[model samples]
Target: MIIDYGATPPIEELSIGDGSHLANYRRVYASSEKAAARGEVDLDQWFRDCDAAGIGKTVIKARDVETTFGGRISNEEVAEVVARHPDRFIGFAGVDPNKGMTALRELEHAVTELGLKGLNVQCFENRLAPDDRRMYPLYAKCIELDIPVNIHVGINFSLKSSPEFGRPETLDRVLCDFPELRVCASPPGWPWVQELLAVAWRHPNLWIGLVAIRPRLMTVDHSGYGPLLQYGRTILKDRMIAGTAWPMQPMGRVIEEIRALPVDADIADLWLGGNAQRFLGM
Candidate 1:
């Protein structure tokens, strides 16, 4: 039951642009002439690769940032893919908080009509902080729907927005306001790792996803993740889950790297998949 908590749905076409989130993936396909030539992902091949990596399931997420990012992928597109491979994939809905009530209705429609399991908020892409007032309605909707909220909770490299938008302290505000909101902070709130850990420790409903980060770095003394590694293997073992952020890091490599970290066997099991299973309600 190895579950990958962060991943984009397979795409047939992906064009590179300054605002495109997938632009970072260009480095990933640099070696594959076929991928570079077609500029598209081979859906079936990606599933085969996940199989080779021992990934039993992955959550498919979309990003809705048409204002800053130029375009948006619909929740319907993600839901359709999940429909085809329901056993292998779960879908998360992305709605632009800037749209206010329209966005709220979209989220309700996504979860109730489209069957998406969670909501995803890329605050940096939207140029909003985690505690931004615009995000509150969506958070409230998630609580009402009883679905989890997955947020980008770390420094984002894209110069298109301010890095401060991802500061982990903002999450504490959200948690305080919505005490019961099930939240998963992705990228493990890096650079602010300790802040995120403290928040998670205080909020039982919050989770951290190791997405787009090299797991092995956690054990490298000055990596700043040392305390996180230690705590994860001890008291916070159930609060962490693995997320490869596919195309940024290969699935097989991410799993193997986490396994090689100096953590106990039980902690490894939880981080690898068990925690995600519980978070995703599997």
Candidate 2:
């Protein structure tokens, strides 16, 4: 639905590392190569198409791909724009959790100085998972700040050597350990939507989101998750949201992709901008 669980910023707007290029990874090589070859990498065109398609707002990450958020917008850059166009965007800080205290401090910068509403953390990139006890310190800071964390779920764009970090179930431990923290699981809900719904039902704060990752409702086998889709109809109708991943895909394609889904006007309203409006608190 139109919810924020910490998704990345517009990658097209970001350079490969100055916060654009991500860490050293093999899959990243393939992904980057593919992106470069695509050549449909203009940022404004993507935003324009989304706006034309009636897509509401986008969540941009402060640091992603960048080893230290290299070229594009830093938390400062994001803060400046969000402060100016607060209605159009929501800022989330992406940090290397492996950096320990520095990661937490960067998060503080996102919240205290940049005024970000939440975080989009790459658990796989940091050599950690949501369940890692060593990372509890970061979660502690999030709880104190009242911000939600969106972990990269499903197949990672940058590709990870280890899949353990991407498991939705790993978060079960985090949910049980810290009941107060709000976390959003993005994509396929892989493993199981029932498990996700069950977990969310158990804890009011846990959530699931679709951040330019496509929707399950559009392609579900419908045998198991039929009811969820039924209940999610409200969100499906009013809260559908999309992210182009910028240079990865043409912005027009993202809008077409949503339009291609089986959802009707009600769901279209949500996925386009309604949900984001609510999630970003716009």
Candidate 3:
């Protein structure tokens, strides 16, 4: 019952479609996008990989690129897949909060009408700060639904240079202001992993993904997960989930990265998918 809170990009505008997707792995807009596409980890393939890896499920999110990713893959595309595999998938609606009320309405429709459970809000690009009270109504909606709102974290993403206004710290304001909100933090500028850890630790309901696999490809020691595991145990273990972050990076690579680590079997299992299962309440 593993649940990946982060996934998807709407395919629109660019010939490549999604804002991050690049042609021939040339320069997809975002690093995750490049990894997902060039790495060949779209929804279908990712599910297949996850199934093989014993990952029971992943919450899929679509693109609403008013500010960031220009919907590399449309919400309808994701909806169809989830509808097809009602048991294997959970869908998160994507929206540009920058659109204000319209964005809020779309999110409600995505959850209620589309049968989706969560939201992948690109608050960084919304041009509207996450702490701003404007998003309170939407936050309330999520709390009412009891679905986790996975926000971008630790990642310094520039959506076509569209003013990345989102940050992991901003979520602090949201959580402090609204105690009921449950959020899953996704990574990019993992440079801020410490900040994410601190916030999630302080707020039981605030969760962050321990982004695995490809990122390990960059670490010189291949033991980056070691510090992550130790840190998880120390502070945010209960608030952590293993997020393959598909459509941006291959799920298999993440597993491999974890495999290479010197973590004990029990702790390692959590990073693979166990933690996600708990957070998703599976």
Candidate 4:
């Protein structure tokens, strides 16, 4: 049972607008030929692809960057998808921290009323550091709701934002403040892979998501992802999560690469699905 922890499906509501900052980074992360196009995606084909890749569930996120970038994937839109295919999709709600109390209300609605299971925060895109005070309320809310948060913790390709906003060290403070908050810091925290690993080591509630990255690269020496493979099979075996960051890469290739990593069969299973099942309380 493979659960893709992070995915931006090709739905109309989740489509990237031309004026959005994500347009600038699309080419960098999006490998699919159709990814460059605007408008509704072939939803049927997307499900077919997931089936072929053996993806049992995919977590789709609604992103709200309205305060800074005028972008949003409304919770209603994400809920719609989950409503149609509850067995195949898990929805994560997005709230802009700059919205202050409004953001907290939105998150409560997303989880309780809309049935979204988690929160997705893109700090860089929102122009706030992970430990920024504005984000604390949402973290607290996640704990109150007993839902996990998936945070963007590594380099962001958007030219409009600095990668410093995503520095893994900032996460350490957030984790320290909310020790009970379940976090999935994603894209494997590259360029600071070791630092993120150290943070993950310190927090049992933290899990690293191998999203928007090439899994096979971790097996190569000097790839800077070596420690993840080394420690993931040992100390961090239960703390690793797998995600395709789909449309960034093909689902089959991502799953194949993860399965091909040089770890014991059981450890590989943890990275691919077991860990997420536990994290999502499945």
Candidate 5:
């Protein structure tokens, strides 16, 4: 089965409240729309598009930034969709780290009560390093719940926070502390690709999701992603997961480009879907 590991469902509106955070997303949405208009995407349309692209299931993610820029897509919102289309969608919950124990309770409620599958941590949005102690509680909660975590682990372009916050090196400490935690470092940790590879090689539970990045660019000579592409097809074949980062790139186009990559059928299958299934324990 083809599973998309990370994707924002075609929600008519995302509540990214006012400020630089909201503005940054506005820019992201605007740039993304250049590839495919938002008017053409809706929940059911999203399912049809995924089907056309051979995507059997999609994990819908939501982000909460109440402590920072003031925005949220509550657990209830994501669970509603997954409840409506249980077969086609999986829900990942986002909790504001600043909420402390409250966030932990919410996460437990999300997985146990709401039936969410995993956790989504936008490290940069939280303005905390991936290894920040403030996030340790949440990590512990996820481990206790036996759900994987998808964390932003690369440079973030938003002006609201330092790009260093998303460094892949930070994850090393997190992995060291929580060796059994299933973590997917999103965006492939570009510019620090080798560092991430080493970390992933050291931690069997770590996975990489190619989100907000086109597979075609990974093969380009000077794209800075060439090494990642090489390792993904070879040594790290089972550690890679495909994600369209929809709106950033059209789902159909992303799938087509990935199919065109110079990799063996087995490697492609693992990268495209098998790895995600294994990571999520589906």
Candidate 6:
């Protein structure tokens, strides 16, 4: 069963507005031309593509950047999708650390009351570092709730915030503080790929998510992503997770590329789905 670790479905709540913070993102990484032209995603077509690609389950995440950027994809909306299609989708809650105690309460509500399975945080978008003091409480709460947290660990294209907010090394302190927290650092931590691999190697609870990034790049020489293929087949084999981060890339193309990566059948299975199964506790 293949599980997409990160994705933005065609939910109206997930729509990107005409905001300055997302100007760069809108131009550079938002690849779905048709969706852009329509100012929305075609939900039916997205599901059809996932089905055609053999993606059994896709994790839809809510984003609550209200405090910093006035953007939010409510947890209720994500829960609604999961409620309607439990077998095909998983919901991850988004809570702004800037909300303080309210964020903690919202997280609990999302999991205990709303039935969401995990948490998603975009450090750069939130304008906070992963190791920032404000994020510590949320990390602790994830441990208490027993859910994994997917943190954006690589560069964020948004011109509003500095990419330094997402430097992979910042996660080192978080891992040291919350060793038991199941953290998935996503987009393969490009430019600092080796640093992320080292951090993941050091922390058994950390998982590397190949989201938003094209799998084919991992095979190219001197791409800096080569170590993921090398260590992913060996020491990091059991902790690598795959995702389409759809709307950024076609799901079928991402899946096909993952299947084509040069790795043993067992290792490929782990990257495609096996590791995600274990990570999500499916």
Give one digit per residue, the lDDT tens place, for model 5 in 70-124. 8888888889878878988889999989888899899999999999999999888
lDDT tens per residue, model 2, 177-256 = 89888676665355465665565556656555654343444556753544445445643333234455544444444566
Q: For model 6, how does the per-residue alpha-carbon lDDT over 55-152 read when each residue is reduced to its tens digit?
A: 99998888899988988888998898888888889899999999999999999999999999899998998999999999999999999999999999
At residue 136, give the lDDT of candidate 1. Answer: 94
Residues 1-282, model 4: lDDT tens digits = 999988877777775445467666666654453442322447787888889889999999988988888888889999998998899899999999999999999999999999999999989889999999999999999999999999998899888889999899999999999999999999789999999999999999999999888898998889889999989999999999999877777788888888888898899889989999999887
Q: Which ten residues in a row have the lowest lDDT in candidate 4?
A: 32-41
- How badly does each model clash, as a count of residue pairs? 0, 27, 17, 0, 0, 0
Q: What is the lDDT, from 0 to 100, of the residue 124 in candidate 4?
A: 89
User: Whole-model Cα lDDT per candidate?
Assistant: 0.82, 0.58, 0.62, 0.88, 0.85, 0.87
lDDT of 4: 0.88
Show model 2 residue runs off by greater than 4 Å.
Answer: 1-13, 18-38, 64-73, 80-87, 157-160, 191-198, 220-231, 234-242, 252-264
Best by lDDT: 4
Ranking by lDDT: 4, 6, 5, 1, 3, 2
Candidate 6 residue spans exceeding 4 A from truth: 30-41
TM-score of each: 0.91, 0.72, 0.78, 0.95, 0.94, 0.95
lDDT of 1 at 43: 77
